[model samples]
Target: MPTDTVRYGMISTAKIGINAHIPAAVKSHNSEIVAICSRFDGPAKQAAEENGIGRWYGSYEELLADPDIDAVVNPLPNSMHHEWTIKAAEAGKHILCEKPIAVTMDEVREMTAAAEANGVLLVEAFTHRLNPHMRRARQLVGEGAVGDVRHFEAVLAFTSRDTSTDVRLKPELAGGGLWDAGCYSVSAARFILGGEPVRAAGFAADSGNYGVDTSFSGLLEFPGGAIAHMRSSVEQPGTNMGEVIGTKGKIRIPHLFEEDTPLVITNADGEERVETFAGEPRFVVQFNDFSECVLTGKAPEFPPEDGLANTAAVLALYASASSGQITAVERV
Candidate 1:
């Protein structure tokens, strides 16, 4: 492991890694993708050839054995995140795992513990939080531009062509709208509120094929009387939107998750303002941040504990949806 650059071994050739993380790593000055692995050799070889990577492994363990690699990017399936992250930590490699780091808090705790014990950094890869527009929104709200945040609403949805074949529709794999897309809304709401919800209540409708929730709508109650409404679905037209309403004003984000766009702010006196942010590739920002954290031995801006908080909230929402009652989010 060289201190000058973070050599990365990619855990899978998933679409997110191929389309986002790999490109971002290439563009980053402090990191490089040295190896890539897949369950089979052909896809790994293809990804390595196409991306100009030097090594390809048919199994993840082979990639982990490379002493020259300093970090690993775990873009594996949701169910695999906890397992691979712990393995990477044990291998003495810092990790950048995908969002909703785990389906449950127990897994989150175990992953965090493993990383801490191994003296490695483990960061949840939530690209939206790294977006300049998102930072600006948080800044404005923090500055009281929203006049003491009272409520938040977020919605994210996209239609899947084949629910039967998609991993997102598999219940055993921790797949569903809430785990897949809704986690964004829950995370965003938590970020804006800057606190965990005390109680959660929700409803979900399962897809007939796999018994995975195709649609989920939930409410979160924060300690300060602030409320958050979140909705997500895999059976609807694509939509991404969020709003933070306060005593004196409100801020609206048109594309909350997928893109950088204008943020609209409206005051009680009928004054409206539009704020535009300089566009930068979000994945680039994410990769750079992870590299900086790993190299400097600094905790990630959004640490593993934050992922635990978000997962706790999501779990509470699921509990509420299941029991038809408000569920309290357990503090970890």
Candidate 2:
């Protein structure tokens, strides 16, 4: 292995790992998927062979114990993210954990503290944040192209046919559309608005049998009078759209989360212009970003504190829904 390259051990053979992270890591010049792990031996062996990984481990502890592996991609279930991430950090393995970071802010703080104490990087894998288009949108907003940013609306929804057995449908596993998709909307709003929300109010519909939220709609109030509306549903047709409106102009992202897409900006003059970005797999970009931070000892663009802020906002939304009152977002 090259001294400049990061040898990665994948902690799970989950769909996201197999379909996105593995391929992304294989394509990254600074990253190598040296090993993959699954609790079951058969799946671990199959993933290793299918993904061209050098080795397979039936247990996560085995992969973590490997000295040659520099990092681990933790795409485990929501409930397992905190535990495994802490363990990975304790093992001196940099981690790219999946979104929402954790179901609660306390868990996020713990994971971040462990990583800091162990001298390992722990980044929340919000792939959309790595997209050039998203970065450009934020730049435009910050530059006042959308003057006096006042409002935002984002929706990310998808219909799930396998709700009965999907991990996303289990309450104990922290399954819900809000945690799965709504977090993206909330995080995007915070990013575009340039601050954390001060208050949040929302409503959620539960999956009767599972006691998990199938749909949620929320409103967040940021400092300086900026407001955002976010919606997510596991029972609706897929849609990904985000809009940021200001006094002078507005920006609309048709495919907010997708990698290759055009951003439409409309000004007060009723004139509109399109901004297009080079198509790059966001997962690949995310992995490369993590690799750069690991190699250079630089803090990640989206660090654990940002993850905690996002988690705090989401938790406030949940509290609002539960209490039927506007809930204050706890600052990290």
**What residue runs in model 1 are displaced by over 4 Å at the alpha carbon?**
none
- Count clashing residue pairs in model 2: 0
How high a TM-score does candidate 1 get?
A: 0.97
Clashes of 1: 0
Q: Report the CA-based lDDT of candidate 1 relative to the real structure.
A: 0.89
- In terms of lDDT, the poorest run of 10 residues in model 2 is 126-135
User: Highest lDDT: which candidate?
Assistant: 2
Question: Model 2, 199-315: lDDT tens per residue?
Answer: 999999985667888999999998888889999999899999999999999999998877778899999998999998886788888878889888988788888999999999999
Q: In candidate 1, what are the lDDT values of residues 1-332, reduced to their tens digit?
A: 67768899999999889998899888887889999999899999999999999999999999998998999999888999999999999999999999879998899999999999999999888888767777888888878888878899999999988865788898777898999999999989888767789999999997576678999999999988989999999998999999999999999999985455889999989799998877668888888888988888877898899999999999999999999999999886
lDDT of 2: 0.90
- Candidate 1 Cα deviation (angstroms), residue 14: 1.1
Model 1, residue 9: displacement in angstroms? 1.0
- Once model 2 is optimally superposed onto the true structure by TM-score, how far is the C-alpha of residue 162 displaced, in angstroms? 0.8
